[model samples]
Target: MPEKVTVSVTDEAVGRIDEVVAALEHGGMHVDQVLRPIGLITGSIDTQRVQALGDVAGVAAVERQRTVQLPPPDSDVQ
Candidate 1:
């Protein structure tokens, strides 16, 4: 299964996140969403592509997006 990840771009590459996304798209990766100001790109990438995505010039970090379960509303710990 492909994993969803949030990619952070380098300060110098902030405005060029699209270029990174374009490169990934050429490899059949999906570019779901992007935040230009923060240089964040969210996409669903195959395991094999994860490394390659990070290797893109503008990309600083690529971290897998994960879900965390929360306690029930009635739980004691606040």
Candidate 2:
């Protein structure tokens, strides 16, 4: 599983994320070229800067970290 991260959202940032979602669903994810939401959620950067990108109106998702338990690596399959 991928690590979770938090991203701050502004009114401006979310607009762009919506566009990207649309593109990903139809235009083959081209919106990823300049601004992408993954960077924010992945903790590579802050959401404020994302909003500064202009095209994005606001941020949508901000995943919070959570704890989970599972079998350790190298364990035999059930």
Candidate 3:
């Protein structure tokens, strides 16, 4: 199944990140958020096709998004 992922771009490649985002969106991929200040992007894409993003000019890393579960406040675990 397709899943959410976070994409980070190299500092030197900042200008081209937007172009990559546009191309992904144009290809029917869902781009949920664009964090330009940190050069990051969050979105959902087909797991099988994730490697395609690596081929984009500026992408430094692609990571799968995972949710963290925190214990209730009263729990002993810290």
Write down the TM-score of every candidate: 0.78, 0.25, 0.74
Worst 10 residues of 2 by lDDT: 23-32
Q: What are the per-residue Cα lDDT tens digits for candidate 3 across 1-78?
A: 787888888888787778878877765458999998889988998888787877666779888888899999999997
Model 1: lDDT equals 0.82
lDDT of 1 by residue, 1-78 (tens): 698888888999887777877876786568899888888888897877777777777878989888899999999978
Best by TM-score: 1
The 0-to-1 C-alpha lDDT of every candidate, in the order given, reads 0.82, 0.40, 0.82
Kindly report which residue stretches of model 2 are placed more than 4 angstroms away from their true locations once superposed: 1-40, 44-57, 73-78
Candidate 3's TM-score: 0.74
Q: Candidate 3 — what's its lDDT?
A: 0.82
Query: Which of candidates 2 and 3 reaches a greater TM-score?
Result: 3
Between candidates 1 and 3, the TM-score winner: 1
In candidate 3, which residue pairs clash? none
The residue-level lDDT of candidate 3 at 8 comes to: 89
